[model samples]
Target: MTDHALQSPPSAPVRFPPGLIFACLALLGVLFLPLPETLPVAGQRMLAILAFAVVVWVTEAVSYEASAIMITALMAVLMGTAPTLADPAQTYGSSAGLSMALAGFASPALALVVGALFIAAAMTHTGLDKRIALVTLTKVGASTRRVLLGAMLVIVLLSLVVPSATARSACVVPIMMGVIAAFGVPLRSNIAAGLMIIVAQGTSVWNVGIQTAAAQNLLTVGFMDKMLGERVSWIDWLIAGAPWAVIMSLVLVALVLKLLPPESDNVPGGMDGVTRSLAALGPMTAAQKRLGGVSLVLLLAWATEGRLHPFDTTTTTYAGLVTLLLPRFGVMTWKDVQARIPWGTVIVFGVGISLGSALLSTHAGQWLGAQVVEHTGLDTLGTLGVFAILSAFLIVIHLGFASATALTSALLPILIAVLQTLPGDFSRVGMSMMLGFAVSFGFILPINAPQNMVCLGTETFTPRQFARVGLWVSAIGYVLLLVFASTYWSWLGWM
Candidate 1:
């Protein structure tokens, strides 16, 4: 992927908006005033805090970092003060209770998110991402259409090594600029829009094919391991998900070409320029060598960790990260890595873990799952019907979330809780894995995924264009996923 310069336009100065302040105050008053008879005190407090956080996230009432911090603070304070049905014998503020509310900060998955960020930063810092893109494009040849397909393939391949879509998108954008310059394509031309959208969608779609490809996939895997005691190996995930990813990538190539319709159909010197750039890179730098070496070590560790059972995913991932930051052998300095890591994402993941734990600890997940099952009678629909219902819900639910990690952190536990009510043959792990794939299905808006945000930063595609054309791509991908989940997954003994 090409490392594109992706500085977003600056927003207006921050001033506390009156409406948001009023809404926050009103929300606090309503939530803290009294407990509903049907809701447990702990659950109520958790719900109130989550509700506030979601509103803040959705409305941008505050910065994301501020919202995440506020959520943690609110959860710790509120849950510490409330009593819960889970432990009628003890108060909510007990060490055990506080652990339930504040465990997000200590979550292994949270550590993994931080580690992944460092790995991505290391790749960017070392210019390894650009080297990969130039080398791939050189062999991909000169046809513009072929270059587009080649670019998509490169993005998919990057998922195997570059776990972060943001990292890959950042890398790919600068490369796309080279292509634009080669073709003399205007910045706002349809060709530019098409290319940018392909990078955005391609990175997101391929993430599902590999278990280690996305943070949210790991989060879901971790949740399922804890909730159902079922561990999905890399091979198992690839078998079930790789087809969906490949099919989606092919569809995306078609969708972007049809919807965006690039103004130029050919690039006369695209391959020559790519080859020249690759030649200029000459040999891999020491930083690139070190980053590449550690990346492989981490990949191998993650792939074998389930069978070997040596260390948790967090530990395995961080081990590679720590090696990258080692003083002499490392690729990047701690200060540089720290400045580059997206702490906001880490904060969100931590708070999300805490929130999910609080929900389970208070039996909120079980209660909500029961209510959903009672109202929908989904379990009575038989295995296939239940699968269809849940899959549809998961696919469409992406509209509400911007961060796939945050979405997975919050939803997987509830989905697992819901599955516990179904028949034994339903395969909770399979269903949860299917939903995990759908977490990457947030294609309809710029705010839906980090890759989408990266595309928006390019100022090429409008939100409305994304929502309109993206709806078709998302719908096609959903139907294809459903077909596979019902057929191939069942054939493989996963359904």
Candidate 2:
């Protein structure tokens, strides 16, 4: 094999540059400015400093984990909050930090993601996902237009099964590659551009379909809990969000098809040929059957989370436990499932949740919220407008950062704070709109989202092409959000 073929994939570094370190310190200093007269206790002040460090660290404005350690050290030395290294070490594992670290493990959403990973793994090992993709392509055939539509439909469906955009891209990209080669389609064809948009849109559109679809959805739920005392139930979330999700997804699909019309010759013959191709794929594997069974049950659980009466967590928790116990049932093994979970995602999610907790505990989020209210005024419509525009801008700015978890963690809290100051009815509408749009608009560049980077590697859509579609999509998406917030949400009685 060639050296390049034998080489391992490159891994991200753990250290920060001198400039980043200085910038982080500068931000930390600003966070401490006009330091509270009482200092919020040495321990609390230390935590405040640590929280700011984490905000930068998780955002990739600095290094991950490095900031956590720095905060520990600072607490031990400057704050004198701990008598010795051992005492500070205990603080490192405090309920606050540990709670954040445990966030991933504790989240039913994350557990659902873990379950989906196992499903993907089992499908791949059993040749089920590949078979499905092949069937899809052959059915769509050489028709560029049909292939584009089929690919989009397939991806949108897959979004239900695959929580992570990057994972969904990995599953679909190979199929596109095969189709491109078989049909003699140019890599830069309009079909390819359509596929790219489909992938990006698929990443977030379904988040509104179900509570477990995206981590950000759960974050919104948690924020609502803080603001309203009870988390938005799964059924409530679906009712409030599904209509918008469906409408926006259709709009996106139409926009992609219109903007990048597929080649005439590449269109599929008819539905009959597509059906026949799909039928050609043999029986589903045991793994696929088992995973699908569990997934269906999970879906039912999510759909009826509140109405069922016994307890909502019961259904979700049961689904997770069943997934973890599948090996004993002869469905899949612990080792098999363990290898599938995205450990990096778990870490990032944990860090994001931790930083969010810290922000709340330290009053940093409130401080930021206060600054915004002071500058923008807190009128209902004005607050909604500001959050919509600011969130759109931040989505682009996130390209410079690494962690979506961190960005959402910090911003959601502050956004929620601002929403609280609005009329009660407007608060729910405005906050939901901002959070939903923020997750959807991470399409300006590859670095804005891991999924975008995955598609970029397919050698299909160029960065320029992705950006062109993204710019238009982002504009339309935000406008739809504003309209929905101002109109549909109120119409549906969500407000």
Candidate 3:
């Protein structure tokens, strides 16, 4: 089958049965009854309804923002917060709830994603991604193991420039596909293992090193700011999370090397073919240079945000302005940059944030916290352990969730409440759980993450193949979280 045939359509034009959607939402209303009597009826009902809407929406491509709007409207009306159509419309517009929903759009992290997309588009336009792939493959010179290692390194380096995992995967997948075809590598064989491992590992590695590397990191920061009135600094995040990322990446690479050693001495279509294909693509264009320069300025702003005044600009505001002005400045056309922004993602983040704020403001998270604490029957270490395990389990389960922003927004507040009840050091435990939830267990399925979906498109690895490695990797990652929290966190005085 051709690529189009193999791929699923992006959206379904036919509306799903309203009865089904309402039935699910109504069932959720029932589930909220036992949540805790301490939760206000309005708050409990809102949570149940939002959660139900999000679940249904995930199974469709109904444009996340539209779904968010529907949820906001439904809540405003059903809860009698508005009491009339005009009231609900006005309430929706004036809502602190809506402002929180739009928070992700105003985040520095989203700017980075937008910047990265333009950069990736420019690189693709300039044939840079293809050129890099060819050069790296040639240097490896028929050594299968070295090629796999090179691919992982290339991806790791690319992460600094390509902020979105999906974009990075898209940029690399075609190159890998061509390489496999050229080499006559069996799609189901060891080579597939190496390709899958590198993509999965690379995605996870970047998720750790920077705030803008993944949407989840930004969501965590946003939610934390709303709940705790504090945000993690980039340097602090790198210091705390990078070591684990490095260790995990290395472990994944080593496992791939051992499990899929190169079997052939043949160069696969030879270096000449690869060079010719790359050469056909030509050098960087003017648009690429402009995009690169704009992106660099944005990165510098983020890195020195706290230290430098920069005319008293906030990083997100700076980026948004630049993104808005770049086209007028003739750096890149608005068409180019606008298409690059993941608006659906922004909406998902906003809606999640709105719901999370409601949960906190109404004391729903606190109510849930009391129930969990009472039932777990644990204190101190037991409580911390319970939180860690719960965080780990949630991370794994969230693999099925498409929106990282939505998942984090909905769950982090509850997790934070659970952590707040812990003894000794609260921030240390909270931060550790946050990191674990942000990075671990996303490799289990393609739908688990954007990068995973990107890798899946290669047709080199099946879902079963991914699960084989993912199961072990996830288990190891959780254990590492426990170890890192118990030892390193105390050493850093974060706990």
Candidate 4:
């Protein structure tokens, strides 16, 4: 064949570059929009940059890693040339602008994120997380329904140990798939489908419960530290959020069982399959034992921080990570985990912090939050009313994006500013904590959560089946949030 004929056909061109075009339009629109008398040029510029970030993020114009770097560059130039709030006559300068762009890297919450990633890597490298899931499954029962409950229990334990929703789900999916195959069931069978959906949805449920469980949680903690001059300690976070997660866990199980009843009540040898799988491992390795001990101690330290001990979650996590890297005490070397961690998560996280800080420092977040409060009439509402409204906003807005981390980065600082501007009686930290829990409500679609996508990959379940359960989970979870706000949370004085 001729060279032209032999060559593969070129990929079809996209209809248009919507993401990049819209991002540019948004940037220009905000920059040129009517400037309120109280808003500075610098604040306006910051707002423009924020708009650009939000559009690109929602549209996914590029990788989040690339977008983070691009946003930083935009801040450096736009902010460097913009007049300072103190003196409109002088510019803020590129050096200060660069520092502002990179400020989030310095946050202790980011350090906690780094350390949590390392812990997840160590667990995967040593296979401890999977083993834990199998062992938990063996105990929860053999019937397809109880097996689903067992999956939820496994999600809870792993949420603590894995400290990553995606990683925790990754550890469970394979074991669950193996169980389905062992029973000789079709991949698309109700039992297989329900179990897979539970693994994905259950992970999202527990992400709300634990502070260290997801990157988005750490983002909220970072914002609290920066804006409120305080933080929700790990234990306090659990105290405030764990009830909703617990109730939702049961609700998820019940909804899945009701919506997708298994063809048979029992998996026959399903429990045996799990037991055999656990037995195949024979015994926990020396690495597993040491890692488990370190994890337990770290968990205790996290729970006791601010109550029994002076060290914070970040500090204690660093201690465990250090032991894991030590020569004799270490479970794995750098070579073992260097390739395992998603370092891009670290980059985006730190940059997200910087963006929020910049928005506040330049008064951009304040201006935007003021406008939102004014338009939404949030100040007219009582404490619970405001919570219900904002919680609904979070869940609704959450539908447009996949990464809750990106959504938090884009909106939370503004949310913080709104809470601050509200002329109502509410604890800043407490309200922030409640709102932060709502940010983990990524239950509507398969694309909303990494774990959901991972579970959806097995072809055992369809997106329709997932959303069928997600709709109920979200509804129940929202109602539970209101109830908790009125009673349990208020009793704790969290409202």
Model 2: residues >4 Å from true position, as ranges? 1-19, 36-142, 265-281, 313-324, 327-330, 379-390, 393-396, 423-430
- Residue 250 lDDT (model 1): 86
lDDT winner: 4
Local accuracy of candidate 2 as per-residue lDDT tens digits, 62-158: 4555544454444334334322223434433343444433443565444544555565555555555555566656655555666666776666566
Error of 4 at 210 (Å): 0.9
lDDT tens per residue, model 3, 110-216: 55445545556555554555666676666766556666766776676666555666667777777776666666768866776577668765676667666666667
Against the reference, the lDDT scores of all candidates come to: 0.76, 0.59, 0.62, 0.90
- Report the candidate with higher lDDT, 3 versus 4: 4
lDDT for model 2, please.
Answer: 0.59
Candidate 1 wrong stretches, greater than 4 Å: 1-39, 86-90, 94-98, 307-312
- State in Å the error of residue 339, model 4: 0.7
The lDDT ranking, best first, is: 4, 1, 3, 2
Tell me the lDDT of model 2 at 457. 79
Tens-digit per-residue lDDT, 335-359, candidate 1: 7767778887777777777777777
Worst window of 10 by summed lDDT in candidate 4: 265-274
Model 4 regions more than 4 Å off: 1-16
Q: Per-prediction RMSD in angstroms? A: 6.5, 6.0, 6.3, 1.5
Residue-wise lDDT of candidate 4 within 1-495, one digit each (tens)?
A: 799999999998867558978998999999999999978898998889889988998887888999899899999999999999998899999988988999999988889888999999999999999899988887877778778888899999999899888888888999999889877899999989999998898888898999999999999988998998988999999998998899899999999889999898776676777788899998899999999999999999999998899999999999999999999879989999989889999999999999999999988899889999999899999989998999899999888778989999989999999999999677888888888888888888998878989999999999999999999999889999999999999999888
Angstrom error of the Cα, residue 44, model 3: value is 1.7
